[model samples]
Target: MTDTDVAPDTAAWRTPHGTSQSVSQNHLAGEVWMLLRRNIREALRSPVIAFIFPVLFPLFAETLVASSYARVSSLESFPIQPYTAYMAPGMMLLAGMMGSGYSATALVLDVQTGFLQRLRLLNVRPSAILLSRIIFDALRVLPAAVVVLLVGLALGARLESGPASVVGLLVMCSAWSVAYGGLFYIVALTTWNPQAPLAMSPLFILLMFTSTAAMPTSLQPGWLASLAHYNPFTYVTEGARALMTGPVTAHALLPAAAVLVVGIALTQGFVIPLFRRAVER
Candidate 1:
């Protein structure tokens, strides 16, 4: 139909996919918000929610770990922490890492579908494409975060500092999610492969395994031990654990924040260029 045949509100108003929407003035934030909102809504829908493997998988893993460790009644004799309490932060990080696959795959799909191209013509900001993916992934992980936290609590995980600590940890996780997700999006856009994000699992798993997530760094040996020292996951896990367990200190928070900032810096460095290329294409 011609523009004259459509309502004024409908005319020139369109979603990034060329669908009808109540379009108005364009700005970077608005564009990002639209993309983020669309992503979240679609994610919550049926069947597609299969993408929630990140959140659900962590809960299952945490439960199994807690159970397996529980079998060793000797675990309680440890002077350190209870099994549940120690595993909570690790599970939280796992969820965040897993959920990021959605954003990466979505970025690749957008590239394949020419969605990014359409957005460019509308004068959408180059950064917005990448930024939206980061923001959306962070928000998308919230439900999984909540599920993991609740599962940890159910499994007898204690949050010594109460609500404030939980909130602080969540904020930190969200930031990390954004940073990590941005990196995934960069790879997705560069490779133009939706499966690229799937390949990320083994790498992140290796990182988590080598880090202090599953055990304290003290037990590690040789180069395996060295990875624990520099791995971002280790700092993030310890930082989050500190927040939940009380006595938040620069010792914990600073290193975590530094890793997150460094990761973000690296992701943005590549994403900005990839986004520019997307726009130019």
Candidate 2:
């Protein structure tokens, strides 16, 4: 009911001799960890947004594409043996993309419900608030990434590389998701509207379709090929493909890494300031 009534262990207190004091400092790392756990638990309670769609949508897309386009692998010019193998990396990336926006939407909901204000009242740092959500956003897609990879193997994909590359590929997918989802955070924080994130959902489809996700650029029409050349996700997909299939060379990985780094830097450069202002408002 009052500070005096609070347990000493959980609250700041001075020794009887006044020789020392225990400060209940809201450390950034500790606060972020606590809030990240809360976010994960809350998401698990509503698994549809946090889990189901992320896994299912990518699985469906991969299966549907592989089934319809199985003949592509038979072509002499095709890169991989089974078309499913080629489709696997892109599908994993798509899972990362699909699993995003939940954090931004959740953050907006928290604001609307006054939960963020409550956290502020408790002296939680703004950086902790935003960083926890960002980390949660990256972590939430991991299950879907794993599921899609397993399904790809089941559907006739092969892992030419060893287990280490698989881990690297998954990590790349999570980082890509964080970068791609930055737009949603910017929109949500800028507008303070839950619906704003939904409007950006079509960008996922556009990115996949316009890029070399499902098909190589050589077979694409002139316009589509031109688009694929500039689409950053194409590099991500190709780099992921190299990791899973073969030739884990710098040629593929470097461009993807650079694109990811720039995407993350640019979007977060905007998002951090925007989120801080939003929460402080």
Query: Which candidate has the highest TM-score of all?
Result: 2
The C-alpha stretches of model 2 lying farther than 4 A from their native spots are: 1-24
The TM-score measured for candidate 1 stands at 0.85
> Backbone collision count in every prediction?
0, 0
RMSD in order of candidates: 4.8, 4.9
**Per-candidate TM-score against the hidden true structure:** 0.85, 0.90
Clashing pairs in 1: none
- The candidate 1 region of ten consecutive residues with least summed lDDT is 1-10
Q: Which stretches of candidate 1 lie over 4 Å from their true place?
A: 1-24, 45-51, 71-79
lDDT of each: 0.72, 0.84
Q: Give the Cα-based TM-score of candidate 2 against the true structure.
A: 0.90
lDDT of 1 by residue, 18-88 (tens): 76553235677877777676566556652244246777667876888667765443453442366677778
**Full-model lDDT, candidate 1:** 0.72
Query: What is candidate 2's CA lDDT for residue 21?
Result: 41
